[model samples]
Target: MAFLLLGFALVMVGASGIRPCNLAFGADQFNPNTKSGKRGINSFFNWYFFTLTFAVMVSLTAVVYVQSNVSWAIGLLIPAMIMLISCAFFFLGTNIYVKVKPEGSPLTSVVQVFVVAAKKRRLVLPEQPWLTLFNYMPPKSINSKRPYT
Candidate 1:
């Protein structure tokens, strides 16, 4: 019973972490700016959602029926085997997938800001604190094509 609960907790944690990132990761494969890219992304999402809904319906109905009527171990094994095959398919497409290089961690930059603030706590502040703050302006030559920029 303890092991079952522990397994359930782990699965919940894993699902929580992966679920949000899954859509973003899939969408990242296409360049959304181009017409074909936009169409591909839309199609990808449509199929992705349809399959997701279908899987849930099957799991709820078929898996539940199997668990109630057949051996509990076999019912659990069915999903496990499906998961294994899906994992295999994912790995097989590794060469074709777009590999994005990760930027530096945001948490590290946040920690550095906190550490700098703590070290500067003894400094005296001016009457207008906002005036003392530095604002960065980038050069026009370094333009970014990204929409966020």
Candidate 2:
């Protein structure tokens, strides 16, 4: 019972993480801004879904057939072996795959702004307006005429 509960939790976590990560990881393979890359992305997703559908059909039919007609252990072993092979292929291609670095979270900025405001609540403002308001100014790339919406 404990092992079953742990397996269920593991499956849930893996399901939540895998789909979004795989989609983003697959998308990272192509540059969507360019014509060729856009076409490549479209092609990739087209095949990806097709393969996914085919795999589902195969598992539903083939695995179930094997499990029913033959030994359940052998049927389970087939997929376990396939999963091992798939993992091996993924690791082999790791060097060629794009690795995206994590940028700091947006929430960090929001928290910093609140903390700064609270820390300065009792402080007197500087005599020069520019010195006091400098932190609130937009980046140099932003045009003064067009304030951020």
Clashing pairs in 2: none
Q: Which residue pairs in model 1 clash with each other?
A: none
Per-residue lDDT over 1-149 for candidate 2, one digit per residue giving the tens place of the 0 to 100 score: 99999999999999997976787788778986899999989998999899889989989999999999998998999899999999999999999987766556757767878998999899887689787576676567434343211
Every candidate's CA RMSD: 8.1, 11.4
Error of 1 at 27 (Å): 0.4
Off by over 4 Å in 2: 106-149
TM-score of 2: 0.68
* Model 1 lDDT tens row, 17-52: 999878877988998889999999999999999999
Distance from true location, Cα of 124 in model 1, Å? 32
Candidate 1 positional error at 109, Å: 8.7
* Top candidate when judged by TM-score against the true structure: 2
